[model samples]
Target: MRPKQVFVANHTSMIDFIILEQMTAFAAIMQKHPGWVGLLQTTILESLGCIWFNRTEVKDRVDASRKFREHAHGDDNNPLLIFSEGTCVNNEYIVMFKKSAFEIDVSVCPVAIKYNKIFVDAFWNSRKQSFTMHLLQLMTSWAVVCDVWYLEPQTIKPDETSIEFAERLMISHRAGLKMVPWDGYLKHSRATIL
Candidate 1:
């Protein structure tokens, strides 16, 4: 048990977190530790069975934090893994963040996601790189890997937005590794929530 909360990556692939959704309310979550859990909702109308928040409470702020805390401090079956960078971007840089993930005063476990060059470049910003073609490529090809670094946990202060938190984590990236948009992950996900 690392902690009640885990800070994960804002992967360029929205699919990464979307893949997580099948595993938990927070699309990036794999398990819930058997207690209360708070997860951000990128795609709405999901009965994810945890605290459902919409791009910083677009889902319902009152319940999101309350529920997350309840699960975090309670006899949780698993810790919470949140993507502080709320939305996916296609730029070569981690974009702005929302603070909800950092609001919970706990330790942050920084996780980085690496991708194949084709996949990395596929994180689309224009019509040509939409999910339709992207998935076809992933289905046909094997993904390249980047070193996902799990750094020592940091004590989170409850005053940062997801974007701010993402920037802080970017400090772990390889030197000169440009940031691409979050869309790269989305292609692997069922849908982009928010």
Candidate 2:
């Protein structure tokens, strides 16, 4: 397939992807797979040489957007990983996806997360936690759900918004696992969710 960004922007749940990251790392030991892991093509990741979107200057965001718009259909091997959640949720229920699905024309893989345990928040050593630190929290936290399920690669019509596509996926994934909805899950550090 061509190189394009997949956006997963669900309601702001917190560290949801953190668990998925760890799951993928472990699943790597399973069997044959396709391509590298997927994530939201955030500008922050782009700045660090991540295949996702880059955070350029204000003027540059537009430029980058245009660049992808132009060559998205032609590039390959460097496609973006989208969160699709758009915001964040506690794995209980997801709100809706943004407009990512309609932005590009390509196949999309939806991964839904279910944590058996969820922590509220935690104390951190640093004043402001780094993105990496947050990820580590989810990895080490027992409150996280160890189970995971990946749905088949489905087609997102050009007319569909990211929300319409993501909701359908989120519903399917949770149903597969029979995971009950969770609530009151905010954010935390090593001491919190862990």
Candidate 3:
């Protein structure tokens, strides 16, 4: 049997997961989306083995991490897809990656996604818009152009810490997209405040 694979990606839009889903039938760790999207998260996404957590809740985060590790080492054939950035960015720059994916002893494959803004801006900016509104914008746009790259896999070196390993993966992602040192968590905090 093939070894377990953990795929990490830079998230720029709500459809980023869908794009990756087309390439591989992998389970994912994701935020608990709201409204109709949450319905799908509970139904279809759960059936596909997706794990959802409330970003605002420490308990949910801890529970999700436990579940994530279990699934990562389980007998499932589907790879684990993680948006290491923890949240979507504007697609102009990549934010800091969470080290949880790297904390696992498994190797990680990096996926980079960039969208062309000429046709439409694909970034969802959840603090400012709803998923349905984002979808409506996409549907009304001329077209959505995106590029996805599945980069070489990465593993933590014998002497490397999980944070360093995560940074290395972030560098690989930055090769295709600009990097910002900000942790995506700040965005979540602001969203919670507003």
| Worst 10 contiguous positions by lDDT, candidate 2 | 25-34
List model 2 lDDT by residue over 75-170, tens digit each.
443444454433344444554444545456666666555445446242232346854676688567766444555566666766766546655565
Per-residue error at 16 for model 3, in Å?
0.2
Q: What lDDT tens digits, residue by residue, belong to model 1 across residues 1-194?
A: 44466556654654655444444454233222222222224234234434454533343655666766666655443556665555555535564445555666666666655545653453544346755567666667665344455566766447766556556665336423465444333544675589
* 139 Cα displacement, candidate 2 (Å): 6.4
Candidate 3, which segments miss by more than 4 Å at Cα?
170-175, 188-194
Off by over 4 Å in 2: 1-64, 67-75, 118-143, 157-163, 170-194
RMSD value for candidate 1: 8.8
Cα error, residue 160 of model 1, in Å, equals 9.6
State the lDDT of candidate 3 residue by residue for 1-194, as single tens digits. 13666898888888888888888677899889778888888988887788889978999999999988888888754788999888788887788888899888787898888888898899987778877888999999999998887778988899998877877775445446778778977775635454
Sort by TM-score, best first: what order? 3, 1, 2
- List candidate 1 segments past 4 Å from native: 18-51, 54-59, 118-126, 157-194
Clashing pairs in 3: none
| Residue 98 C-alpha lDDT in model 1 | 50
Q: Evaluate model 3: give its lDDT.
A: 0.82
Write down the TM-score of every candidate: 0.59, 0.49, 0.89
